[model samples]
Target: MALRETDPPEVGGYRIEDRLGSGGMGVVYLARSASGRRLALKVVHAQYADDDEFRTRFRREVAAARQVSGAFTAPVVDADADAPRPWMATLYIPGEDLGTHVRRHGPLPLPKVRELAAGLAEALRDIHRAGMVHRDLKPANVMLAEDGPRVIDFGISRATEFAAQEVLTQTGRVMGTPPYMSPEQFSSPQDVGPAADVFSLGSVVAYAATGHGPFDSPSPYETAVRVVDGDAELDDVPPELLPFIRLCLEKHPKSRPTPDELLLLLRDGHVPEPRPLPTPAAEETRPVRRPKRRRRLWLATALGAALLTAVTATTVAVTGGDETAPGDLPTGWQAWHKSSKDPSVDKEPVGPSNPFNRCAATGRSLVCAGDDVMATRFALADGRNTWARPIDETADDLGASTGGTIIAAHSGRVYVYGADDRPIGHDGMSLTRYTVQALEAESGKVIWKTVTGDGPAASEPGTDSIAIPAGVVATYGDESQYYALLGADDGKVRWKRPLPDPDEQPCMLRGAAGHAYLICTLYTGSDITGTSVTQLAPTTGRPSWTVKAKGGDLDLVGQTDGRLVLVGWTGNHRTVTLINAKSHVLTTVRLSPAQPEEASVHLVDRTLYFILEGGSVRAVDPSTGRQLWKTDSTVERSSRPTASGTRLYLASPSGRLAAIDLRTGKVVATSPGRDDGTLLDTPSYVNAPPVLVGDALYVAYGRRSVYTVDVRDL
Candidate 1:
């Protein structure tokens, strides 16, 4: 494959020459050192760079591969597992992997299978002598070099003396490819020894000759079941090689021939007379979790299994200065829930299109806004609604609701929309003109208020105005759309410019990382013609760059590591687009296995978290376009997650709050729904993502209620 435009030019003095491939962990590149020695470099993805657990695994892999040295195994050449994007380089073996070779051509001939079998056995001997067991041995992991087949990718390997693998074995968390795994590996991983490699070698040899494994099945779970049940499918194997392969796949680990013994059997060109096939394990020997675990029985990398076991959430602040131990919350912080209401005491949710309440933290308290309430400050230490400010009583009708939404809060100032008095228009009718205001945080007094675009109302959150790192950008006007960048302190317009209107329709303005973007869509009747995101310069209202896509359904959710993340729905799947803010390089991803119709997505720390309406959550790596894990929970119809450390904070429409473990995709803890059990204040708005500050999580729910939940309590 060619190197992608987004691929790094070099890593740790190694110049990237070509693209090799990519896996769940990272991308592999064909690189060369200063001496021009060719090597294959594996660079970890940016998303996993900050992941402490993943870095530990990368270090272990580097150490394990460094210990083993043989012609049959790819030797570690150079490595720096501590680099920003951790990488390890190994000898560049010249041929394609056995799996790809077989896919391009047919199954290997008898002579080549013998060569493959002999080489792999020798590789196993070298690995075992180094006190390591290659847990994952499959055709894809075996390279058919000119000299022999070389075993590679020791990422999941373990030392015979390693007790860490033993601890994981006690739990139901199983790893390794199902069809290629040994029977003993599935039944008792803690008891796995060097013989497990011999069994996998047999499976790899069988696949080389027959283009399939002896325990192949449509689904990985079914394949795992077959392997555990000792159901071998060997009809396609050559008669001469059947006995040799059979001897290696003995159900009992003790019965399986060791790598040393396998080398003796293949010493000659032909095998001796076949011994009787070993008896299969009885049904009683199968693990007890098999039958009851049918829904998601197989524990493997594919189809979203948990990446790591859930650990207790940590509350270490990202801010510099003070630090705390794991699970320690900020001083005086307590989990509390409260609610308020619109002046009319509305019985149901005020807005059917967008959520009513939203919040942002400033200094020692949280400033919030909703459909009915203009602005309210909640104590950060508790859930007290310190002060509430309802929408001004204007004679003219306000757009969306009487209350304005909070655009942002910073430097002890809260930015929100306010309604100017109703005045008769030129058409002899009372008209409402919205005003954008900057209010002091201590008191509900406007510092400055300006008339917003006298155009159609923005019913959705972030459609009309959004806060950038510099200040707030408010969109106004109809047909000819215009946006102005207001100074954060003075509320004075820093710059004003017209936004493109493809079909004479207004474009939505959004902000991310101090950058302003104009989301434009052109439609013909009910069908969308085109969609594009044109980023505007923060200092000046000038177009920096614009990227166009097919249709307008996609939304600009967030940005991470200088890449913008846009999400859209297609059929039952969601398409995620990652674009480099500077390079303009685009990478599109289609979430596999499809998602529920009501599924929502959020991006944080370069990872995409998707939540289904029924509460199934999926964590996907946006860089690699792979789903890390999927977990089932009951935190239904929750808002987009506010990520901190290894936990995700979210709230449901009914004010139910859930703290999810980011590493394991498990629900750590959840607070009960509102005592009043009302959804009027918290409408189900996709744009109203949750907010996390320090060790406290502030969420708006129920009838005008804002709650503060401490991670330590969860």
Candidate 2:
């Protein structure tokens, strides 16, 4: 690629030539030093240069790269962290990245695969000997030099010393490409040793031999899931190499072969002659199957969008096949769906190109609200729209202007908070009058409306603004210190109270076990402090119990058997905290060191499950705080998981559905995701979690439509 005008002409006394590539953190350029030595200069992005944490991380990467001394690895030449844009230079091998090579030349032969493995093993041995772990070792980070291969990119690498754990965790960054990451990287990143690099090397070797990763998926999240719960796609791989690669791809890091062991096996010539394996049946490899009705509907929609009907199915599946068992899908129902992009609704402009649609289920009816659309109900049996109403023009304009939406439909009532910006008094200042309106869920008729005094602007634009449960409707800003529980029937304030500490802000509010609990976190400027969990009486706004958490951010999973189960994170390590509301006895169990800041935790019965950003799901026992099982679902940006019976359901933003067995943590069934042909710069709206009512599951598709699935068929 040619160097762009914005790129620096020179960096760190190196003469810039052309661009090598760009990554999440910075851009790499092909440059030459003053002495005429070719170099790869990596200049940190301007935006990241201003971040103190990123700067420190960049410094560590430079330091780690300098420590490594190996023939099959790129060596650091020079670096200047104090420069205007921190930059590092390394010996630029004259070759292409492994990914590019594979994409252009197809899969490599067995001999080439063997050679690549040996080179990577030697490189890893050198890196491990230097007391460093190359946390990220994807294909794109490996260079196919003329002699062999050179491992590069230490941006997320860490020193093996004890102090490195603290330094790396302090940044709270979950680093690595999902498809190439080890299971431990997703479940316990900070504790990852040299074995993680071996796992990545196996993935790279698989890609080299098959032109595809062992756990390839449409998104990184889904790929991560496969890395954890699914099997390697080794049917196309050489039969003799399958066993060697499988050992490297084991879920348990300790079970994987060390670099030294791999070298020994390669040197011993224990690998057999390459032999072709029988092609697996399509049914065996393809897990997600679309019903005939879904196929026809999708074809029609794709034709409307002038796109070919290309459906990509998931290759991973649970050990158990999708069967009509006692606890599977409900009876007397078949899977049915309706696209929100129907001709009637597609023509209506919803202000934001991609707006997030929120949905709630009552009985068999699903009510959804978003953007220009107020609230619409659909029959869960057939996905038929019962009623559709346009939001009030006054509220619509305000929501569009501020990029906010009114959340509605809960407990048989639709609630909307609208703003009436009317100027009052001589000063000509517009008084932002916030109105709380309640509408009939079935008919969409305005039942009652009340004016709530000027409240803080909604903390989150879409999903986190309102919570309606049982007899009360609660509203709070994402970071507001004040919260109010309104009567569900009349839209009147039942009880409003300030959080325990005025300086502390509430991050989440939920109603569980007939009680409303507020989780607040203390913030000193931009840094976070200890979190406070308080149980409040909905009727009287009285506190029942309050637990002050440690320094990490806290997420309230839910109450299990009268115990509050929460996941807390400090640095990169996550811990499960169980608090007994009555006894006020708090037990904090430190989990393996992993990045849990961006994970969503849910409590079903006595088990708490964590869905991480990288698409790994782990089930933990709150009583013992022991992780029962961890599986990868490869569904990126997935909705919060919902459980029923012994099955757990999860949905991604792209409309992919995955069902896991609660007892085994294996994916039992999956649905081919719906990919509407709309390409927007940003997601239209936040994804709503799958709502499981009886034998049916309801999912909000992007910000456009809602669909129902009969669990029995799954």
Candidate 3:
């Protein structure tokens, strides 16, 4: 986030300040330390800065990240790996990981999963007595600190006196996270040792006590053939920690246990005791199919316009003149830029090219997609792309946005989020499905598709859609639990019901003053315990007022004046509540020093941006919470700003481009990105936001370009 206008505002001397995440070996940031601590750093990605085997695996991750310094780790506060892009830092660790606290609070409490299996078996017995071999201990490398479980990534840690190990196991690399690896890390990665970090700490303590992954499958080559055939699902685990996690998932590596005997069987209790069992009675208990859209993959790749920020869920008009008569362009408009890959008219790429696209616009079309990009159709004036459909390519192993997203054009149709995968009756299995189409926004043809979900969310086939003026709105059964709507131009469902989702934990549908709502979040396991919201009924899903609320985190953020705002924090100040979408009466407003709880708020035009996670922003004043001015949107992990009156736009998923001057928060222009290597290929998936269309903006780049720029050229 934030720092990327080609980063380096300080790297080896540490000053960067934002972006703690990027991957495929590079980008980390959130720097500091010239006596102001908070470090993290990382670097190494200027096209692998002239790789010599990625600078020898970043010089063996800065020499095994400086011998793993202890106290539950976040050590190595400085490194270089012969500079020029290679760097390191560390010591930042402030908690939130353990797979994002077991996916926003769910598992962990079998005494915190046996105290996270005795603080990750004493941080793998101090990185196996400092000689390394962490070989990636999952749950996103642990973290969870209130003075406890730390671990962290020594990038493919390997230092039993580090010999080459084939430049650290790199042939078509599968280095870690196949449900916490270990079957000698997929059948002997240079004979992985220290018992593969005690069998990835018995699959990260059975994914912190069952929030999944104990040879979990639905792909990863079937969890590496059930983690090399040791196949331990350990049914809801807790039969007193299932015989020391079935002797640390033993499938040889000298049949498991040593991180000093898994910390002496977790500090002398010898482990197995509190055995209970026999429950399953309420009609033989049911609930476990799982895949509850996994937060719809962060609401279809980064708040797909905050799940339609409200009002007929945007029938185009974030300033795009409700259809070309007075300003929002379109009558043979100018400022051109194209290439949604035109290799003599499309179809050459069938792989890698997904430079994370994503789009949505109407009154002058737009389209776009990602993950091996396809649903292409760009023409908000001179960028002429035209039609594109083809690429279901067996849904290319469903890894986020597989050729689908047009996601809403409305009246003259468009919609998208496709994917099909053919044969539902062959012995060779194939059920990807996904649909929601519509099309014909000036002839791409097909006017109705429908279906909605299928395995691996098919790659966000429009996850939790929404529009509704009697048209879009989605969700379908199999834990999406129903609710339909459809008919914008005849796919015809016209309202179905069910989907209130009693305690479904990670809920969220959103929309707002042209109504939809939903929200949910109550979770009794691992505590969140209250936050319902409801609202629905646009043509009969029928709740129209529910609320529930207890303690903090309410969130909706739009409807305003006709009521239903939301935002909330409550203790050290930041409320703004509101409600009354017809006398529901709430009110609040507080707001002081509490913005960044992973920011993102938004609102626009009635003020209250917030944003943060590095592209900065802030503003506030949701009617008297005041604050109002903070800048920097130099586009790094951006997308989702788009305003229009006094500018705002935004982009980056390596397409770069920012704008921002909504009243002097000045970054008025910035662009440069995608000098090829899409910054380690996924500079944050499916970004695609700056598509404005009237005073021309468009924005999307590399791996098949789009470009437009000219909010009066900033």
Candidate 4:
């Protein structure tokens, strides 16, 4: 029978509107704040009202919630965590919990999956930064609002006291929901922290993706034992998201990333806000005053029931295999052939020398440039190094720069060089400081060279230059110069404009709206010192328009048709924007946080593909702000994306290249993923983006070197 809504005997001053829900330790009701704001008010059970110990615990819980309130979490409105009956109030978000959402709608769509993962990760980062742990992070605690996800039900354990006791066994032991508990939670609750929440996040991701938990054992005992001693059963987790999930579920807390670390690893765009520093106080508190014996028994029994026998069997069958082996690719997957790391150097680059590889495709080959590394090319048809030349590495070397225009893929081979002969060396010394050179793709000979500044600053190479079909060169300058120069074939500067120096961070020359634009990070010395973007004229260095972008650095993907697309970070959220340079228009699409799950972002022809940190891919239209379609593939990092006609290609880090149906986002073919953990701590990665040349896919794997995968299946 249903319990009818009734007035609460009393609460500070507001009257209870209706009973929202009831737990073993307290009854939650819809209540109003002094100003009439709606709140979920939880009042302790009558039996525990007389216990001083319970009140103390409730106070602690309230204190914890107050310390860590922000966008990702439901903010506290009012609370009496230490009241005689132990009551607290929080803003009531309107949405079903994750469990109900999934039960009603089935698994989430791929884009939604990525959004959830990113949002949850950011949320967890906020929770942890406050120096507290959500000991009980589960699907039931998440609310899926239309704007995004909001984490709720914090500090319930302390307010109810029964929450902890209810989950304990008859042996006077405490336990969590078996499927959602982390190994640390089971083996040592006292030792658990943010990482424990990560483990629960893994379970949440698994449940959202495949309708089952990672360790859904047949019985509560079995589930507990598996969580403490067995491998995570992740059959339904897509291959791409596997690594991210595994990292979160690492048995060793040290192996797991902090919330901030996870945010950095999962995002490919902008962050809007700096995660506020966690308050010195704890963020989560457990109620300790309620009855222990009954609570424990009830918790055990509920967990046991939730792990139905059929569910466990299906879960085991799906994720039973050991998927750590290298060169293993999911069926129908394609390969991407570019790498962010150097496969030949053996040792990873010393610093974050280059966080990402700049890529562009024309005709049938892929071209790439990186920090301190000269422009290099690999045949898209086969994984073979076409040519690699060393560029300048000094702080201000213009000759070392290769922005993006090295080889003109669309037109015939042409060399880029300085029109007048100026001494290439710095200070005219014997040290031949080379000028910027553009070489012929097939011949590998310099077609053009442009001399830059002098001294150590001049020793470094400038970014890639753009070679428009009209023979105009667009290149960015160092800190001293803001205007990216556009030189005629005769080598005379057409125009120059000063760029903004915000944080004085590295700036990139990107093309959007069929014109050249500048993207840089402006630090305001405030809470948000993250990335921001501004559009500029290619020749004049004038602001066409500017919008605040997210991220520490920015990269230019390409102008599809004419829309200027850029990716940046704002806090933990990656904001992707499509700007119309001609109309001075912009459309910003923010990705939801990647939580226990993982995701990647790729822009193809104005269609944004959010590759879940898992291997599932969802295609969305940035213009209309709608999801087009999605597909699932093998899980792996270091995979680069390439497009041929209407089809997209993906290369596994393990050596497999795959062809995907662009319209449907489905993998039509695949190769293998290389396993290389030698550089887990190092920057060198075997698998990166694959280069597509004609029908071949070039793959670079960490420690394993580079290889090729054919696209016959596609």
Score every model by TM-score: 0.51, 0.47, 0.29, 0.40
Of 2 and 3, the candidate ranking higher by TM-score? 2
TM-score of 3: 0.29
Among all windows of ten consecutive residues in candidate 3, which has the lowest summed lDDT?
287-296
In order of lDDT, best first, we have 1, 2, 3, 4
lDDT of each: 0.64, 0.62, 0.61, 0.52
Colliding pairs, model 1: 339-705, 340-704, 469-514
List ranges where model 2 is wrong by over 4 Å.
Answer: 1-334, 340-352, 355-357, 371-374, 389-392, 395-398, 401-411, 414-437, 453-470, 473-482, 499-508, 522-529, 593-596, 679-685
Question: All predictions: root-mean-square deviation over Cα?
Answer: 19.9, 22.7, 24.4, 25.5
Question: What C-alpha root-mean-square deviation, in Å, does candidate 1 show against the real structure?
Answer: 19.9
Query: Would you list the clashing residue pairs of candidate 3?
Result: 1-19
Q: Kindly list the per-residue Cα lDDT of model 4 for residues 1-714, writing each as its tens digit.
A: 133655454487876777777765667888776777888777777777776766776677777777775588887777774566667788887778898889888988756876787788888887777766777778888889877888876665434433344322211124356689876665445566677888888788778887777776433433553464345656556654554566667655545656665565456322222233324263223211111111111112223232211111111101111111112221232454444333223133343233223333322334444433445554444435566544433333333232222322322133332211124546743233434555444435555555543333232333334443123334424333434343423334556565455345556655432244566665655454544556544434566576654445455555554566665432232455665645646676655432112445566545666664446666767655566776676644435465544567665544445567877777777765553443343324323355433334444444324555544544
Span of ten consecutive residues with least summed lDDT in model 2: 290-299
- Which candidate number would show the highest lDDT if scored against the true structure? 1
**TM-score: model 2 vs. ground truth:** 0.47
Task: Give the total clashing residue pairs for model 1.
Answer: 3
Candidate 1 — worst ten consecutive residues by lDDT sum? 313-322
